[model samples]
Target: MMGLRGINRIVIAVRNLEAAKKLYADMLGATFHDAHWTGAPFGIHVSIAWDAGIELCAPMPGREHDSAVSQFLAHKGEGIVTVFFGVDDADVAVSRAISAGYACFHSLDYSQDEMDQHLGGRFCRYQESYVSSADRCGFGVALARIDRKPG
Candidate 1:
């Protein structure tokens, strides 16, 4: 069971990993979790302290141009697709949010150090609406309900 604490990070799935990496690293002054989780689904590339986590998730192997990331790329043409909220009790939050009418995207349970590595924070996302800098959904993939639990 996880609970909402505050925002820890956000994941922006991109089509080009290197391009997004250089853009965020040089332009946004962000850093990667490690060099290992670049192309992995359950891993991220950038880790922000108190802001959004922009993940340029690559369409690796059989997942080329036809996956969630790819769909985001095709529709929005490369940018933030998923937002991970930093919460406390994930299960509890999801249950509460669903009861309140929010749809669950998914849930994750892994050691931050062993995987995503941003203070070991585990998180989840809701289909709530959020206005990206692009104003795609008037609220695109809204708020990422998360927990600040140490991974």
Candidate 2:
């Protein structure tokens, strides 16, 4: 059985990316890096706050209606969308969550193509799986395994 080591990251969905960035920066006194567009496929852009390791995401304008970030914003407004936890092994954690009766609602692994295009040709191996909110007291929780070798 897999266990969550700790929280690795928190994903926040916002309606206005700039406004949210400014707000978080002021509140945390943090600096940020260049924005990353997960592209037309994900229809979102994200800015990572290095100090807090929090990712601020907002849906791309044209795709707002269909993007997951938009959906989250609609459902819960400007707040945390999900929490990603670090695990020893993603596959094992998934199996354990399933065996414990939590359904896997979403799964994402950084693909080679995505790494190449979005990460400036650097490879970052990571897998994340979300357990259904129903099983986690209505809060979305994700388990992730990151091969922190390099990016």
Q: Per-residue lDDT for 49-136 in model 1, tens only?
A: 3432554565655666565466666776765555545445455655665676566554445444543353433432222223232243
Q: Candidate 2, which segments miss by more than 4 Å at Cα?
A: 1-3, 111-124, 134-136
What lDDT is reached at residue 69 by model 2? 77
In candidate 2, list every pair of residues with a backbone clash: none
Instruction: Give the per-residue Cα lDDT of candidate 2 at 37.
Output: 61
Tell how far residue 8 is off in model 2, in angstroms: 0.8
Model 1: CA > 4 A from native: 1-3, 34-52, 111-151
| Model 1 worst lDDT run, 10 consecutive residues | 124-133
Q: Best-fitting candidate, measured by TM-score?
A: 2
Q: Model 1: what TM-score? A: 0.60
How large is the C-alpha RMSD of every model relative to the true structure?
6.3, 3.0
Writing each residue's lDDT as its tens digit, candidate 2 over 23-131 gives 9789988676545565346888787764686878888888778886776777778888778788988999998888888899878888877656665553367688989
